[model samples]
Target: MNLRANERLSERIMPRPHRRFIFSTLLLCTWLFIAGCAVDQKAEVDLYRRVLDGRVAATQPYVEGESLTLVRAMTLANQHNEQLGLRGEDYLQSLIAKNRAVANFLPTVSFQPSFTIEQRARDGAPSGSTGSNTTASGGSYQDSGKISYRTEAPIVGSMNLFRGGGDIANLQSADANIERQRLLLLDAQSTILLNVAQVYLQVLRSERAVEVLRNSVSLQEARLKDVKDQFANQLATKLAVAQTQAQVNGTRATLLQAQSDVRNGRHTLALLVGVDTINGKLSEQSVTDAVSDPKHTLTDYEQMALDRREDFAAARAAVVSARAQVDAAFAQYYPSVSLNVAGFLYREFYADASKWNAVLLANVPIFSAGVIEADVRSAWSRLRQAMLNESFVRRQVLNDVRTAFENLDAADRKTAEFEQQVQAAKEALDQARAAFANQLAINLDVLVAQDQVLNSELQLTGVRFDRAVFLLDLTRAIGVLPEVTMQAATRPATLPGLP
Candidate 1:
């Protein structure tokens, strides 16, 4: 019953018709402002599509199941890798930050219209007293208290006229952060390309291993058949047949493991390329046929890395951002200034009432209980940390160059050794076959030498694969993966409102 009574009371106090018009005007102004400033999702998506088309390489044929080439695999990874896409968001947000800093220089305007009703007892009146008080609008009430109305419809605005150069420092800091994010995005693209290439080579290596193992199995089966024929003619013992069958079984097991490695390697490559599975054959030409010596010395590679590495450039940008933050923090020791203005749309008629008014505000900071000092110290520490990180990144870049160069060098040396070993095994196999034809060597000797030759060839293939992968690694370590894979480096990303 009391709730019903309150509802009836509220209905009786519905806004006056003139006040409703004022409310509608405020609503319309707010809607217009929001509509003008809001981000359009469709436009943003279109922008993304256009920019992405120019940046990423096309891999339509590869995605539709063309055989997996390393170059195509890299193209697919650049288009579809989830982590690389996530890194792109950082670059996008940095552009938003750039716009936000730009907006700090603009004025903030709003419509602030109020229609307040006050119902209170008279001054010094007892609690729950029924006495009335004169209202602001000159009204008298006798129910439980006085009733009054106060209304205002004003357009207000404010702008930061000055802030001890802090605004300028903040804008500079934001610009530096933008450049840093762009460089990091480039680094991410290079990283993904190198990863895809590594996995692609892994699949190639496993496929080659499987091929070598299959060849070994075929040779072993041929020998087994020959031994069975000898046993049937009473020229070989049953124990000899059993021994030959055991060797064939062992070779089959090794062949199965090699086949499994091929499948597993392909699966990994598929995931890196963002595909559900990869069951196609890799190009045989992907194998390294001949390896050459390093084209540059270790010192030369190190210098290239230091000059071309994107993460190092990003680290240097971080130091600049930190220094700007320090300057902004110190600016708190100076004064700030701003301007505020208001124009009344619904003004009360009075002899001294003004249509509009403006006030200039200035704040001089004399003391802050050490708050400003603490901020300065924090900024200085961050600046120091950024400087140290830049130095550390430089060291790491050199280290990466040296490590990759050394690994490639060692792999090249092993290629020579493995080639010699393969040649010697082939020579031994030839001599053994000749001796067997002359009945001077046993059949088992000839078969054993042939197996040695095949094994040596397999080892040589593995060394060549290693050399190829390490060469790509050296290219990546020197920060040239983008140049080699995509034929161009990723450019700085930009968006709407970016300067």
Candidate 2:
């Protein structure tokens, strides 16, 4: 009985011809709201998943205070890195912008209830007549001073059928922007990876440098002591002892500087991994291959980078988005159509403007004081800027690949030269030791030959370190650092052009 009464009340309140419109509009709005919420929820899930991964990565299998690996550093950075987290927020913002663009192509519903008051019939007939207007013959008795009021409560809904392609363009632009942010995050990841690896390797390299210089200092000290002993025996000159002391001082100075570099490298690594300090031994891992040669040719690397580089792809997407904006701006020159409907719940002093009303509104732009023209021109300017950026990024991608490829080749060549130098130094050192054992050469000659051999090996090691850094650079330039390293900087691509 209650349900039937409610039906009759609804039918009486809104004409049967339009009652379904009210229910359908409500459902549409509800669905749209739910969809928007779902989009937000999805973005949240994605962002925090990386955060979780970073936390989990911190729990490594290595013994505490023993080593910090590249994998561990990257995972921790992905979570704790403020800059990357901020970029993730940018991704969320783009999602929201897309939501706003979507709303343009959807309907809106609102409830408005209002009350009004008015003064009526205040004119007096002949001021001296004295209340004659309030006589029995007077109608409505306005001279007696009365008030009038009105009330209306309505549920309104509106939907845009067409405007310009601006809605779709804005949507496309938002989609492109999302890709751009994601690619930027990936690029940042690769860059941070390079920095961490460099710093980590540098710390180890500087430590090795310190060790080498310390050994040289020790050798010089021993030689200086021998020179002092011989001078006391009147076998060596005082000048020889002074020169050996000078050599020891110089080597010690260099060793001090190398130790400083090691400390600085540790500080940099700590900062890069988003920690206050890296408080432990860093396990060494070689990032180089035994045979350092590009599987692909130089030309191939250049072309491949243009395709694989995330930033370059992002720049291209920006151009597509900007072009869409141009079309959207042109859309403003066209007419727009919309539908507005209202269902009045109750009314006072509005019996004639009764239960329901609807208006199909169309706005034709005959003139706008050059506003649309200005908009179109501005959009075109933006498109031109995007195109220019895309070109610069394309060249940059090619250059990165070419530069790393060439540098690796040079390092490889240096490797050969340094190896030969080391071999020759070792042969000389052997001859010096043999000659000294036979009493044919002085102790100073043997010390000098050993120093030369040590320096040669150090140079060879340096060449190998340079080869490793260049190999890592080539990996980064190709935009596969995360992939080849087995660490993820981003999720799967969301758009068509992204790979």
Candidate 3:
């Protein structure tokens, strides 16, 4: 009885040991799961931190006292503009294509390793496995089964010896594509520069207009004050005071409009220069002095544009690229040749060996449903279109040069005439003011003279602004703008009141 009791106690103890092992295993698994979660959470936090840092960097403010000029604006636009970035990506792709085309002439190498298992059946006499003749001698026979395994590792290489010049033509086409992208980038730069110039000039013009109108308003205010004093002394009528106040109000309204224009221009310039704000003052005198007569003749400008224009160069590159495409298409008419080499190691249930092999292959083009011929025709059509486009661009360049030249000449003559008008109007206003003070002229005549003087000054400002714009346009048409240094100037703390 004691032996049986001890045996039952040992069994119970063994079962308790198994339970403890199970509990420990579950606890360990739970700890591992928690640890994995903690690791993943840590990684997520790091990623979020990096993203937040990038956001902070992108939102950083521009530096103070950063002067914006034509060249600086162009550089900034090129660096930040999405369109330029896209073109740069395209250029990179073209370079990759060129490299790929060159690689076609180099050999390609690869490796393949594989394992195979097979089962086969054989006819034999029981365990002895005698031949069929033994079975015919009245011996018992049965079918036997066997399993086998095989492994093979191979290194293979191939190279194209000839592709009827298609590879060469493709390489040439890639080169042309690269050239086209470069010229396109240059064209984009020129266009951005011109746009920046336009906005810059507009800002200067609006600011100057504001200044002129402020002066006019001040003069009108003074005149109104004088009229009010005369009326108090019974020397001038209340009607004169009312008219002078009306003139002041009108000038103030115009000044407000000009100030609005200045703000809008600055906003546009900020966007172009990739800055949050534009802070520096534009040099009006420097800009006016930069607008001079073109030193070259119209014919010379036309020739220069033809030679230096990016669009013209891009058109030529397109023509060459199209011709290469034509060649690539024609290459399909001929046969291709290639060479292959392979080294292999093979193993089976009964045998293991290694071997090397070389092969030369030739592929001759057979009858296809006019696919190759169709491609040739399409390529030729594109080539023709490219040539025609080049011609059209040439004609367009000529027209632009001549038109810009004519407009610039007209602007020069108009500017000279307006200068003379401004001088005469100032003299006439002086005489009118003197006569009014002496009581030889009426208040109406003096007011008309003041209006004429203001009008003449405003008209002169417009003419000068137009002349500066025309000069820029003419230089752009000639495919070369005179470089102007960005002069450093202090920003004014305050502008004059608009109302």
lDDT leader: 1
List the candidate 2 regions with Cα displacement exceeding 4 Å: 1-45, 48-66, 117-147, 289-294, 349-353, 433-451, 487-499
Query: lDDT, candidate 1, residue 130?
Result: 43
RMSD of each: 6.2, 9.7, 12.9
Off by over 4 Å in 1: 1-15, 33-38, 41-56, 61-64, 120-146, 237-243, 285-294, 350-352, 437-439, 488-499
Candidate 1 local accuracy as lDDT?
0.74
**Positional deviation of 190 in candidate 1, in angstroms?**
0.8
lDDT tens digits by residue: candidate 1, 76-106: 8777777766766777777788788888899
Candidate 1 matches the true fold with a TM-score of 0.84
Ranking by lDDT: 1, 2, 3
Candidate No. with top TM-score? 1
**Worst 10 contiguous positions by lDDT, candidate 1:** 490-499
TM-score of each: 0.84, 0.79, 0.75
Clashing pairs in 2: none
- How far does residue 455 in candidate 2 sit from its true spot (Å)? 3.3
